[model samples]
Target: MTNLLRSIRTLPLLAFLIAIPALAAPTIIELSSEASRPAINDLVRATVSAEATGTTLGELSKQVNSLIAEALKTAKAFPRVKTQSGNTSTYPIYSKGGKIESWRIRSELSLESGDTAALSELLGKLQSSLGVSNLVLQPSPETRKKAENEAMLDAIAAFKARAKVIADAFGKPYRIKQLSVNTSGNVVQPLFRATAKAMMADAAPMPMEAGESQISATVSGQIELE
Candidate 1:
């Protein structure tokens, strides 16, 4: 009986030792994946602001208001044309102090549409009337999603390629352990800032070219090494 018990205990110990090599194998390497794409739609937001000076707060206010109203009246068909009036106060126009400029009101307009051509035409029209203060273009949601997915797929492919290379280099087969990633997309907006607040201007319409804006997304993650 003593011998039999000793053999049983030794057998368990032997099995545990034999299992160690299979349980804690050192044959796998770590791999990672990352992807990124441009957020196109999210960034395509454009704000057109018009700036002008008035002799007094009331006078500037009236002019800015009038111009915005007139622009809207003409652009009845244009979509996403939103206008807002901003604060008015004395501001130095050209570093000339004590200009005692009466009122400095601003009219802001924003447009969000996929039709870049129409938007450009509308922007040109707006500039022709209201003097331009600033113009900003940003991406939209649709663009962002598309770009992000494309980037992610590319990144995953890249990671797989790299893993293949590593596995081949090691001269043995490997399996994936774990994979994870983090990603971020930035908004890249083009800014057209005018010295004066944008308003219906006297000069020729400012030509706007809303060209293809590159949106970018970046993804980073690790894959379990096998």
Candidate 2:
């Protein structure tokens, strides 16, 4: 029992000794580097919605559904455009007396295409029966991936250059103790919107411009100087 007690007393000292070497190690410096490139937005996405209000929920739903269905069928005529159903929502409208006077139903249709002209023309057709809710132009997956990879390579090079400069400034040899890389991007959304009156006036092709997005990559790391 006396021997065991002595060993337990030494446990704290042993741990302190074990941590001494790590605490006395060389200085660790942290640095980060980034690179970015503009990628062309080759894809277009548009959201169109149909909404109806009626005293009967079933009637409102039917009206909204019929318009969405017609929009989908019309979208089929554009071979380059792909169509999909988006959100479907039903909510009750309240009157001044705080009572449910009518129900409103709304449904959305999402369209995407690489051919901007075809998509623009399709939007014009869709706007005749449905309201344009949102429109976005962005880089395609392949394009974004390529841009990110290129940026990552450049960022890595920049990080290494910075590390070398730091080591030289300190007059020490260094090794990477920890490293991490990340990539980010933002989607390009245009300011143009189609109004109900414009859509009803004539079946004219909507003007569209596919913008560019900046894709960036960052490399961060800690270096241990010896």
Candidate 3:
């Protein structure tokens, strides 16, 4: 009777050990699929700065600060545009003799808006007092998220289709052993550099062209053919 009981206990252990090798899938394959689409740019951004050089640091600081403050006040006239202070730096201007000749101070104001036309008009007005340093056009967060979700769905479908094709080619059934999905987009546009001196001189409503970005999603995984 003791031997019979020992045999019963060993039966379960043996079965578990036997199942381990079957769980280690031998025919595993890795595959990846990607989907991308053009997303329309809906946001416009501009960076404007005021710079002054004088013998006194305090005087340069006052001038640069005053110009940035005036630009912020003008930005308020356009309710749709958003304004924020960027960078402020004070540095010494060196003379040809390697002596500090004067002090220079510069401050930047960042502007963003969904209404491109209004923002463009504001930029022109601000350029009269401040120099236009940079301009950018890109999709807003909401728009980019929507595009990413759409691309993810397409990419996942493509991955599954490819897995099915591979399984069929091998004349075997398959199951996903591991899977991962990632998303990315061309969010960084090429830096637009404008001649600040010339822009300040003209101060016309800045011309802009809204471009598109390629938002993409990739699905990668390993599948086991049974």
Single out the weakest 10-residue window by summed lDDT for candidate 1.
216-225
CA lDDT, every model vs. true structure: 0.58, 0.89, 0.87
Report the lDDT of model 2 for residue 74: 85
Cα error, residue 113 of model 2, in Å, equals: 1.3
Which parts of model 3 are misplaced by more than 4 Å?
1-25, 188-191, 200-202
List CA RMSD, all candidates.
Answer: 5.7, 5.8, 4.6
Ranking 2 against 3 by lDDT, winner? 2
Error of 3 at 9 (Å): 25
| TM-scores for candidates 1 onward, in order | 0.63, 0.85, 0.85
- lDDT by residue (tens digit), candidate 1, 6-74: 999899899999999898776655556665544433223455555667566677767767776777775
TM-score of 2: 0.85
lDDT of 1: 0.58
